[model samples]
Target chain A: MRRGFPVWAVYALGFVPAVVAFGGGLAGTTGPDPIRALEQTLGLWALRFLLAALCVTPLRRFFGVNLLRYRRALGLLCFYYASLHLLAFIGLDHSFDWAEITREILKRPYAFIGMACLLLLIPLAATSSNAMIKRLGAKNWTRLHRLVYPAALLAAAHFIFAVKSWPLEPLLYAGAAVALLAARLAPKRRPSLEQPHEA
Target chain B: MLIRVGTDLPIASSEITPRSLWLRRRDFLGAGAALGLGLTGVARAASPYSTDEKPNSRADITGYNNFYEFGTDKSDPAAKAGRLKTKPWTLRIDGLVDKPADYALEDFLKPFSTEERIYRMRCVEGWSMVIPWLGFPLAEAIKRAQPQASARYVAFETLVRPEEMPGQRSFPRIIPWPYREGLRLDEAMHPLTILATGLYGEPLPNQNGAPLRLVVPWKYGFKGIKSIVRMTLVAEQPKTSWNMIAPDEYGFFANVNPEVDHPRWSQATERRIGEGGLFAKRRPTLMFNGYESVASLYSGMDLRANF
Candidate 1:
């Protein structure tokens, strides 16, 4: 109970958005262009998860909100949604046309950055388990997981270019990502004795 | 009047639309103020250029749109466009035209005879729809204005009421507001270029550009600027809203060319809305959006470069 909400509930809440996005999409409730709508909705959820996971640190630092136990769950959810976003693009948007998909990935900077972001996440997501962390040692695992910062940045870039215009929603998401990351640069006190972080 | 079948508005059921079909559509209008319109009850002629293809459902047509003045998302307009009051609207036509006046919306639409024109609309975002637009040719108004020889281009502008249009008030400006679009004089005078007042045999839904919108079938859908407030005939080519925003991605001409891809997305194929559900293959896009009769307009020019 001291840990607040259970980690499994974090996962359950995550699946709710996935179900709503893909389920609403497949059922044609999202509108006429359900494939594109679903693709974007999944991508939006991924960004939200990445931002939420990144928030765990700042909330602990400033607001004294300890959501550390669920950080792994949030990060893993980001990976799941990111993969779904790509699946929608490939399976629905491009229909598994490897040649066309490859050409688009090479040609558009957004596609290139989006693919690169998912590739970068693969290693972090793979190593998220406690057993893998134990094998890699705490110091190395922390360093490797730091890849999330760049992943967040790349995810924001992919969203901006994909939108094609600098609309407020994408820009607001981008601003939040940058601000959450920049919060790390703020002067800090010594880490709490209960939850020691990377030195 | 140099009126002949311009292109691709193929002679599909040129006779009057059946009264029973109009009665069937009456149930579909759903509280829209179309019944009050004088254009109602007058049997509209089927366009010689009208397409035989089934038009998209009114729900799909209105529910999904890109009236950036309302918002950026496809569904944003449908949700937010209710704030716009289509009543007491004014249209200002000036610049190199014989008659330059700020005419009321009704007076502006008074002269032309209305008909139903079905056009295949292709979006720059790689989606397409077949829309049955109820309006008259823009050429009819252009002829009435009697453009001077200096009028090489015709520019149009959308209304910019920030109170009604939430998008106009957005900080950092998603698009430079009072969205503007233009067409070459010949393109404007072409019989296919229509000033659409309504669609689906009812008043145009606010989301789908209520009151007034342009329909240049040969060009991309963005060129069909909505809720038009101004028309200017100028000597030099005008700056369009999208072209002004991103010069490389959106060019001035913006003709529907499968060969000329957008900087981010392929234009070679487009998913037709309401055709097939989620897993269906996208249909191949056509040059000039399959309106081949207008090809002569760009005979010597390069579409790829103009794109």
Candidate 2:
């Protein structure tokens, strides 16, 4: 219904970053360590999409910018990027060695947390479609999607732990994730008697 | 060519630039171009100690680095290291040495002739590069200093310039600045150890430690401290930067042993630079990084425990 901000445009724009990230590596522009560049590019976009999706709720609550229609598209984009990140890790990084991948996911704290976040995202992504939403019912779908809150935290923690240093870059992302989560957790204003709901 | 191991083949005559002609050409290129070739001017020379395996491309060698003095990112060094000034450099030799005095880089380097030693440099982060470093053996300098009997270790320090090094100025410092590294007295005197002044037969690039850097081929690349300013002979083991930050993961020795893994990742293999695409299988890491000659340095000690 919101023609000012199109959900389809978000989907179209979301693919651009991924294309650029992969194209840079394929074209040898992603520096000497292209594996790291590509994986980081996909992973960062995943986290950014999650944060962008989180912003949709706040935008409507505070500024009365009812862009809630784009939330589903943003959430799906996050899932897609997260999936690609995982694929890069499992195949490109580890050479499709399932045993090594499993051992890493179990023993490495950062990898373990990152895998856990992806697992949580899977269910939400599976149920994002209208048919699955209808089958699961609105309340159940809403409850399932709330898993993103913890996933965001896990993603932030994974980013920090992977660096293994107190660098400013990872810390900045963690701070942004925490701030967005706090905004979502803030107590909601009671429906005002005088304030008419936007049609 | 393919990765040649355990072979020290002589370079073809075509590849070896006549030293006199090369020097004249370098003089003509001016100081800027003479420092390092811009991804195309890679120089090559044959040495008995040099491995036959191809050295990494100039771009990868310069662009991909772990010089945290510039910044933590691998590419940050190439981007920000241009600010470092290498002209009129001075190196101070002190702490338990007989002749403790400052020597200009030119005067200090005059005592010994530079050698072209193409060596494999392995980073603790699981990447590796075969770099051709040009410098004299570290023993030349250590012997010149005439260290006292009490001196059992060598401590090296990098210059601390907040104006030039943004990492030093960053709030919530990622590492304690004026980065430090050390080696045992014997390790410092080892023939494999050198004070690298240049790479690819060119003056060392700012990103790759301009004036002078240490090169211990048998150890992890971090142990080869960059942009050095001071060398101190000490009685006790000296504190190192990475060890100070994460003692559990980085040990004092920091030797390139594949058996002892880091806390977060395996060290059994490394991704060779300029090898292939992302999916290319990593080459298995070797003991002492294929410089098997250094194993005796830790003959009696347990590497796992030390690691």
Candidate 3:
């Protein structure tokens, strides 16, 4: 168990929120509004996993922690949570009412932004496999995965707009997204050639 | 705590239904009719109306609240309102009333008989619940005050104490302190308008507006101001807290209309509390929250324009 953690563990961990939410809902433990609680929980976990996936590179570069092996798994898990979040909105909130769903998409800015983020994640989730990486080539694969940054920002904005008031929780998530993106975009430091060599 | 069981209340034969039967069904049916009806007779006879929907669980009703003075979070009121000192509370009735007077909490509630009112509470945020509130009609109290002919509107105000209510001290101020709401004089005098004092057969929990509060079922939940401290009969429309903060988003006549959507969200559907799974299906919202009895009050008025 110490040598290298199984990727299946990450997959298993990802399903925990869904199970807990459903279980809590059925058992009457999700307070007065179980559906809203469930929807919010799923969406929050998706955002958290997306942020975790974003942190993988920054952690390795800044803190020298190598979690590269689990990066893809984390990304896939983020996509999985996002899919559930979308399904919860469409099936539970809207009850497959296409007309109402369309009207909501048109009226609610947050809903539109959330939908856009999910759409961007689809291609990344589809191409997460080793075979797809080989087919696309390393450079093209890296380029395609870059969509995650925008997706993360949009998800953060979606969270902020969803609430009635500007509470600290959504603001904190938005701050983290901004800081992570700044770190990713910052110029890489290089050793100066003009500096004298140490004896 | 007073546990008013279904079998212990007198109910009208016409009011008995599948839902009411389910509540009073098993025990009352098996027991003799005289014994069963006799017990529930007083409560049922006094209560003029009630909803068919099952009341939300006591925990849900008290645990989830929206007393903004305590805080903006739904759970904040439940967490913070325990510190509120409700025993020494007083209510002031003034303005266009001939007999303006201040009454202590006990004295304020002494004159009227309390009865259970099961109502559908729909929040502007698109969530809904059926609550069983125990209180006397607002008209009973208003009648004692003797409003003059000039009194066209009634204004309600909540208690304001920053130390007791932390949200009042919030920097940048989410809402102006001493939350206020108003209703047309006719609306305030309506039979459905009540000053709630208890829930689930117990004195109202602090979070759920202890001592006294208003329950205007036909309007959005916010219109039912909490922990009321003052009532004034006025000649003009009074400024309400939400309308003052965002006039466009919250109108004075904050009636529940599916067609009139909030600027940020749709009002067509609502997420019913304690129902469905994580993605609970949103049921279509009814006009005036299904209180068609009060429809005539808004006759000839454009709801969209007024909204």
> All candidates' TM-scores?
0.89, 0.90, 0.85
Give the residue spans of candidate 2 off by over 4 A: A193-197, B1-45
Model 3 preserves the real interface contacts to a fraction of 0.59
Q: Per model, how much of the real contact set is kept?
A: 0.63, 0.50, 0.59
Instruction: Give the B-chain TM-score of model 3.
Output: 0.88
Put down candidate 3 lDDT per residue, B1-307, tens digits, no spaces. Answer: 3322112335422244544453554356346455655645422432547886777777788899988788877889999999998877889999999999998777767667777788999999899999988888899999999999999999999999999998888754777778999999999999999999877656788998887899999999999999889999999999999899889889999999999999878999998887764557788999999998999999999999887
Native-to-model Cα distance after best TM-score fit, residue B1 in candidate 1, in Å: 32
> Which candidate gets the maximum TM-score versus the true structure?
2
lDDT digits (tens) for residues B161-218 of candidate 2: 9899987888679889789999999999988899987777767889998879999988
What is the lDDT, from 0 to 100, of the residue B159 in candidate 3?
94
- Give candidate 2's TM-score: 0.90
Residue B122's lDDT within candidate 3 is 97
User: How do the residues A1-199 of candidate 3 rate in per-residue lDDT, one tens digit apiece?
Assistant: 4478887898898889889997997787877777677789899999998998889888866666778788888898889888988887888777899998888888888899999999999999999999999999999999999999999999999998887655568888999999998898866545453122211
- Model 2 chain B: worst 10 consecutive residues (lDDT sum): B1-10
Q: Give the Cα lDDT of each candidate.
A: 0.86, 0.85, 0.84
DockQ (model 3, Cα): 0.46
List clashing residue pairs in candidate 2.
none
* Candidate 1 off by > 4 Å: A1-3, A191-199, B1-45
How far out, in Å, is residue A175 in model 2? Answer: 0.7
